[model samples]
Target chain A: MTARTGVAGFLGRVTAMIVKEYIQLTRDRVTFATMIMIPLLQLVLFGYAINTTPRHLPTAVFSHENSDVSRAILAALRNTAFFSFVREAQSVEEAEHLVRAGEVLFFVEIPAGFERSLRRGDRPQILVAADATDPVGTGNALAALSGVVASALVRERFVGAIAEEAQGREATSQDAFEIVQHRRYNPAGTSQLNIVPGLLGTILTMTMLIFTALSVTREIERGTMESLLAMPIHPVEIMLGKIVPYVMVGILQAVLILGAGIILFAVPVEGSVAVLSAATLLFITANLSIGYTFSTLAQNQLQAVQMSFMFFLPSILLSGFMFPFSGMPQWAQWIGEGLPLTHYLRMVRGILLKGSGLSDLVRDGAALFGLMLLAMGIAVARFRQTLD
Target chain B: MSERAAAPAGTGERSAADVAIAVEGLSKRFGANLVVDDLTMTVRRGQIYGFLGPNGSGKTTTIRMLCGLLTPDAGRGTCLGMDILTQGREIRAHVGYMTQRFSLYQDLSVKENLEFVARLYGVPKPEAAAQAALERLGLKGRGRQLAGELSGGWKQRLALGACILPGPDLLLLDEPTAGVDPQARREFWAQIHALAAEGLTVLVSTHYMDEAERCHEIAYIAYGRLLAQGTVANVIAASGLHTYTVDVKGEGPREASQRITDLSQKLSAALGVDMVAPFGTSLHISGRDAAALEAAIAPFRGEPHLVWRKDEPTLEDVFIDLMRGKDARR
Candidate 1:
């Protein structure tokens, strides 16, 4: 053939492949919708849902003194948009229970003589308790407490008293009702400390799910699975072999992201490196196995991608990476719990932020380990082992 | 290993033989549709068995059954002297199935594809084996070239290389030369014959007649049923088709060609004519009923420009006749 014919022939074959791919993509309605609709959904949904300066955080009050001054103080706290008192705790113990159960973000305590002291010019303290497990959630709320308190005293009687007793108190910290605020587990509310650890789960979940899902389905779509099935290799062997490479990829991605997190974000790793590594490995395997299960279920690479994105949608949106897990409604929390990311997020945050060890994270570790088994079991069971 | 020694574990009740594959009453049904129905066939060791069929005729389904890639819903078979039902993995170990499409990793280099397959089959000294395969398949200097970058013919060669890299006893090729050029197809057959000479049994499916003729034995199937089997001459002779070559030379060459084209259409639908196929410049009119076909074409025989002569039926003619007869019965 002439060079002209060769060039034309090359173009002809190239165009045919391109055209075939376009036609396949357009013909598959689910895949087409997933390609177009998912990113848009993620953008709009995550844009509104992820709030770092989370307002209307559930706060409860326990005041031994029920007077106008204390009421004004609580009302001012509400007005600051930092706290919304949804419950009235009868005692400080009840408020602590609310915080531990994740029912409230902040708990307030007013001594019985608080209102009387404000009137009589005797300074009495009021205590504020904040749930700081997810330190990012309550950081801003805690910072707004003093402002909420100082403005509350600006009401009619306290203002006149402060002006009258200028010599006694130019409002030296002694005269004001001292708002003792407790910044929870992560007192400094380090953003990197929060995000870097979460990256271990988020990055693994994203890459692991998409990689293994696409890899297996791609073999089927490329016609290689038929040859693979005809070979002597067992289905279990294929599954594990397909998994190990992506697991390595996942590990590499984790290391890179974690490195970036530590350097750029200054995220701290407080817990044992070995614990974090083991949990992360388990989490990566879980995501990959789930992806492999999806690969077995899906007919083509596009369908596999769609399945991964479907899993990713809930994971990114509700897995407590982008939003506080406890802040979401009970149903969303339940859904998040069912996802492996939820448990991994808790473990990473616990281990890296709270300095939690293996014993401290046994529940989340077990949940993650259990999820890996279930996903892997389903993947092996669903493997057809034949073209049929 | 001898036949008995080569026999796979768990099947001591049956005697071993030269047959690489043997099946009885094989049937497979996909949901409500039966794909392969009560198919009984045997392929002798160390021979090229040509499998021919129209599309959707269960050619692939049958090949799958032979290699242990599929299990027939109702059948008993042994591949390489191992029970296919109980020893699918054992059967798969000794069989190489080349799919209709190029199935090796396109991203991998030629050498890598060979090495991967070699490793998967646990071939001894994989690097040496892959190198030998590369050299044997004329892929010596192009070992580093990506398999995807090769032309259709080269891709086919590479796929064929992967199939034989493991030293499989039986190679099941599904339309291995479907889109390859004539020269490439010829070379592919040469390699296949060479392998068969070394006692590697092959069951290959194809659409081309010349390739079918190259096979030592052939089987024709259509719509999940086997219609004919045996050597090339045996299949054609058993077809019972009487073919007549019609040559027309009218006033001008163009006019004669046009006349032949027009006659082809009419003769295709003529009463008692099974098929009227254009064979190059001539037309082959064939039917199962010799007397009826001769009487049907007798009127045209008297035309001075036309010469009618009896001809041996081609494999194409036999397959065409088999397909038509099968369709008519349905």
Candidate 2:
């Protein structure tokens, strides 16, 4: 009878606590709005703003000769949806100027002897120059230009047997003229296949950190923390209790984002699903720990939110989420390496696109683990023992 | 230890084993200012101990140190037979401390607040404990109502209910009835006395003289010093104040008050008077010496505008005398 009573008593206490927490949660309108509104807002914003399969790239062409051959190539470029012909540049210098100024993403220049070479049974070379500042933009432009050139070669084969016969004397149809191209990642080149994996890091960082930062600070402002502190529960238990619910929320968001990436953008999960999920969970846990640490240092809910934004600003800018890590300066790369988000971004991208195994991601995993432990330890130690 | 363990109800007569809380040479200082200085007192088990002092007199600080919420800078004490410093958490587990301000969750229901407190203290069967606490505090049907929606009186009741839900052996109430209506304060005191009757030790700080009178023993602290400690009758007797009431008729009370003030100053030389303050249409004149008090009011006896009579000094008169003595020392 005593044992039964003890169990009943413990259960009663837990139930009462959960009910009280529910009452406070329902009353806190800001947390309620953040939990329901933020996810929906992120979904809509990310759905439209993020496009992995970049297409219909704007390109300009400069032709020194306005002959029928150059005109046919320009028409082929215009007919292809991949290359939207921006305008015709009068000279090679003008097209180069446009590429330098970033007005046109890529430019095609046909040399002066283009029509004479085709009639004389000699292959003509087409020079493709692109502004390689943004690797993604450069890669998409190169792919579109390659497609247009391949179709133009096939059209030349049917125009006249003399064009093919004169080209056969110097080389076979396969080696008539080569389209020399340069892309940033996968320079041997594939476009949408390279960037889809990197989007996971950006999505996780934005959602998980914002949620955890506000939850604890809101409890402090509403004066519910006093009741929580007065309980027999330890500080570590309280910290875990607050973080566990948010971890579940973060996982749900990850699943939805990954599902959408696969269905809409054709992003393939080339690596082990279990490994990817584990890495994602680790990254989310680390981000949430940072949020909890921010909560402990902040005096109010507004300050907590401001500190979260301070963390998020650096994560987006210096984590190499949108920009290439290798392209940045050495000092900038060092700064990026210091951020846990940068390591996570690399890990996710490496796993999804490169099919990297555990040995390849040992550094990123260890960095994230170290950061998570440090942040959670500080949060637990610094959380105020008294309500005051 | 046996004396300390005896419940307050059983110890009707004073005995060696009557102390509930005992401390000697208790002192606490904040920087240069002494917040609690050289205080010594003993409270019997089950006594309703009232702490009376003006603002900034360290009443709250003293209560906090007594309940183990704060450590005294210079003091050795025992609460419920345990050392105050070493056994603080153990003492805290058995003590219920209510701050002057409303510290309960405002957004939660009264029932929810009590349940949370019960869970905090690890009370057995918290819902049952909470229900019993609510019913005891006369808040039976208002369980579903939000604490924020309650009136000041109801909030006070809920706060009291939360504090007592754990069935603590000692209760420390710091101005628990402040801002409460008069009737609510009366009802609250009745509940406090009932708890004391059940062998619960209560230490309450209040500014009200009537509340001080309700306590089994009252301690008057002024400027961080324990000026007096005793029952109402004993404190008044120890104050050495001989008071006289002068009832003025057929004139405005303000004019009568002014006339009495004028007469009081004239007789001050012969009487060695402490204070002469007007209370409504009557003037209450007090002094330390009995012979001098009789002689000082002799002129007022012959006045046709007033009727004079000797009366016992009230708790307020003793408190005012204590305040004046403190100021005079300063």
Candidate 3:
């Protein structure tokens, strides 16, 4: 029954608006896709993929000892499942090179006299070197090595002496084997040490993309771009003029964030400030160019914002911000390698945590710069000087 | 021979110095519809030329082509003594285009908007030029206010001020005063005429008959085709419309005005009375031929309640006739 007045009419009007909104929402495929797909995609990708205690870390064993005890230790380390021995290093120098090149996460060196030390009960040291540039990547692996050592001597060959010493209140043979861990890069395994550097790239990426993506679209939305195109300005000049100011905004945000990170988190800038500044400039410009490209492609402000977030989603998840870069699958990592943020995060972490100089960041930094040039080229090409 | 070389605006013939904007065989098509079709037109120096057309009749597209803001799909022209196709950038430097909408940044202050435009045009002493534009346009003491906060009339004047700040030789104003009050429109036209008197060629597009009448020369276009172009008297004469003014009397002032409206409605459906519009205390009836119009109104001629005499057709009659004629063609 309908009393087609007052409250009923109001309800009818509200329902009318609701029906209109649903119709409009369904018409825009991009918005509809974003509404349905983004949440489900992020949930499935991040839910099963993010593992805090990352295992199967590529490890290398360096050994001069061929004793039964050394073999037992290597077998114990392999049985832990956290470390996978991919190669046998010829020497310590070779092992260090493997870690430096990011080929392996942990290097284990079983020193000489491992069998003699076990027989004499003289605690022989086992050195486990780690690549601590990503503290999250190596912390759990380093802490779990003690369990490897305890189970390393569980065989009947050394149990009688270990049992006799245990009865006499002397040190067991397991105690006689010592494991020394050297956390390289970020030795203390601090989260801030890892996060503060990544924050620089992430913050710049979010702000630069949004600020520039809205600028050109804003001019068009307000009907100012037609007059702008009618003037004697080139497309390159228009892109640059719209972009350079936002570049300054990105820099200002960078300076504030970096200063706060230094003061509040005590995350040390181990490398030269000048080198960090250069990489930051290149990274900020790259993101701004990408945002400008989106502005040229988007017809309206809503589409511009949607485009920005679609790019932002991949950047936040796959750029090694929330998860360890090496922990992700090969396909995910391949996609990460293509994003500017991935390269920028590496370059920033290299400079701040790893004490990387300009020469040290040449590979990732150059990739970031090349991305900026490509984005700038696309933006200039897509930016039409006339409405036609 | 190519339409380029054969048309009057062709470089092979007249020089670009005399014409502020000249385009020959201009045509533009969007998908299947011809928004502008093989239209040729020219405007001389220091003249205020009016473009009158219905909406979607390609007035803005033609204006943009002349100013080099748009490239015609098929055409050749020159603006400011430079080829509109190849030398668009050079032409843009010399032409000031005021858009149909209020396009200047509304968030910016009035003076700031003027200054930004001045800078874009590379005007020397930009600050002084902006200040002078503000004072000249009667925007003094309001430089700090946001442009969006200004009334429609003030916004119109500020837009004009911004256009003239660059000192361009040719100005293309697309409906400068569409919604402005009559007083403000009068002032705006007066200022535009003053600017034209100083050797600045002006091309304005409008729908108002009074505004069209203010132009030195008026061009009427309908449905992407040029219908008529001439002085107001010439256009009216060229329409071949014989008109009659029928005044009503023997009634009170209000009653007489109402009677005039009734009479206009009565004669509106007559065979030869093509247009019947109320004017003050009388009705103006117009048709294509004198004999047909007289024969149509002869039944009302002997009525004691009405008096009639021959009159000239109005500018509005000619334009509406031209519009209706185009509509009837298809």
Candidate 4:
């Protein structure tokens, strides 16, 4: 009987504890709402917004002759559900520039006299240069290239032997033409080349954001902010004091990650080191400003951390860190454009893999600058000077 | 109004420079609840003002308003001759506010916390200032220790040391000795008196009655209103309560205690008896009218084994009467 009563007593104490916790949980309305909303948001975002096998990738064509066979090949490539012919370059130089600038993923070039040579069965070659920096984005689209072009020529009756054979003539060899494939930037299509630079952006965003997000809220929770605010100092001075130290830490963190990326993963910096440093500095400051803004908005340390995670989830998911940028629907891409990591990822990859200069990445750099100013503005405007 | 009107002569009329804090008609509200309502008082230079009230009775709110930590929703005030609303930053520069809770950074050492405050207020030679403060507060040996690692008494001392590091002319302390030991509290008061002798005005809030008696002047507040404000003697005299002490004898010690409890209950329900309280082995009964009190106690005074003597009412009795009277009016 004593043992049974002891067990019942334990159960009774546990019941009281559970009831107390439930009441506390409900009293904190922000935490309660976040608990229910985060999971639902994740479900909706992952299910509808993400796509792995991306389609309608931008492509450019530079055909030497306006022949029936070239038109047929272009139409055939469009019908394959993998390519979107967004631009038709007037010259090979223009097509190469389009691919290099990342405006188009693939450039198709047909040499002069290719149609006459094919008619005489000389077996001429056409060139298809693919921007292979993100292999996942261009892999399947490049794979369907030769088959679609060959079938389209036969189907269009542009192949001389195939057309003649339709009138009961003897058939000849069916080798219509040749295709020359050139993979630019990363010729070997190594995944490490793509992932390492992306990891640099992802790591910086997570750490810089969380560091500053907890800075002010921790002071507030510990009651130190009360004494600090009671002093004769401006709010902007306090904000700058909190942010400047973390910027130094952020710089050290960037160096550590980039050093590890190069020494361990063999990822080469193909562009000017000055340009990379400038962009990294800008990106770090932008993330820190955004995190400080969250700190001002949150009521306490726990809420500040939750707000950081809420921001980080979208950054990692929609910033093309895990998936191809072109794979998501249009609206999701627009949302990605507003995130700093999305633009940073482009600049880092453009600098590291493709050796893009500052002029080529100016637009992305400006976007990061604009985001930093906006977050800083909100943080300053939301700062409270009194205990009202 | 009665307390102010009955203030001891020669202290009320002062020039602007003689006043450390002077405010009229101050009020503050949070959401739907009014925390401080139409309160007004003045503190002269070099005076140790004691702020007394129950918990959540706006003691801290009043102190915060004085130091410009909080803006009064409706009123005008001045701290050290600077306007509370228009010149908050200037007022804060001359005032040091030690919050009720320990507000120094726990992760920092004692010296570091002091130096941080010194630098914040732009004190020259911050390192030397922090060292001198440590020596003065008797915390020279604990300079390297974290503030959070100290006991309650030591933390309170360190908080005070940090507040005075900047050498402000005025100090506002909100219950600095709430959880401290008796010995520490006495020492803390001695330090306050020493500072007052040096011409620094201090406004400290506390719940201890003995501490209230130590103040040069005191203010009693309840329900967001200042019920009384004056010298301690003046407040007690203005209460106008006639008190008597009664000692009841019974068969044994337990019986005597029981007799006193029963007598207290009976006297509480009698006419003209406004307050009945037990202190030690004696019972105290107080009333507003002396004649009515004498008639009500005539029957109890003649009872067997009961001795009654007229006595002066204590500060405790007067404060209890003030609190009860406020409640009855509400």
Compare the candidates by DockQ and give the number of the best one.
2
lDDT of 4 at A46: 35
* Per-residue lDDT of B245 in model 1: 94
Candidate number of the best TM-score: 2
What is the per-residue lDDT of model 2 for residues A330-378, given as tens digits with 9 covering 90 to 100?
9988888877789998888777766778888999999999989999999
Per-residue lDDT of A137 in model 2: 56
Question: Which ten residues in a row are the worst by lDDT in model 2 chain B?
Answer: B1-10
Q: Compute the lDDT of residue A201 as modeled in candidate 4.
A: 85
Poorest 10 consecutive residues of model 1 chain A by lDDT?
A: A174-183
Q: DockQ score for model 1, please?
A: 0.22
lDDT of 3 by residue, A1-388 (tens): 1113344333333333233223333444674454334333433343335444577899999998888788888887777677899989999999999999999999999989877876676656789999998786776677657544644575536645663453333223332322222235643334566666766777678777876787789889999888877777667666766666556566767776677667766777888999989888889889989999999999998999899999988898999987768779999999998789999888888888778887888999888888889988999899977777
Task: Compose the digit string of candidate 2's lDDT tens values, residues B21-136.
Answer: 88777888777989999888788778888899999998988887776656788879788777877766566667777877777778888888888777756676768888888888
Candidate 1 Cα misplacement greater than 4 A, ranges = A1-139, A142-182, A327-333, B1-15, B249-251, B262-272
Ranked by lDDT, the better of candidates 1 and 2 is 1
Over A149-263, each residue of candidate 4 has an lDDT whose tens digit, in order, gives 6657778877758434432221232322111211256534455567677777877787778768987788788898889878776666666666665566667666766766577
RMSD of 1: 11.8
Model 2, residue A266: displacement in angstroms? 6.0
- Candidates' lDDT values, in order? 0.77, 0.74, 0.77, 0.80
Candidate 1 lDDT by residue in tens digits, B64-87 = 988777878998988888898888
Off by over 4 Å in 2: A1-19, A49-58, A64-83, A96-106, A110-233, A248-281, A329-340, A347-363, A386-388, B1-20, B23-34, B252-271, B289-296
Give the lowest summed-lDDT range of ten residues in model 3 chain B: B1-10
Interface RMSD of 3: 20.8
| Winner by DockQ between candidate 3 and candidate 2 | 2
Chain B TM, per prediction: 0.92, 0.90, 0.92, 0.95
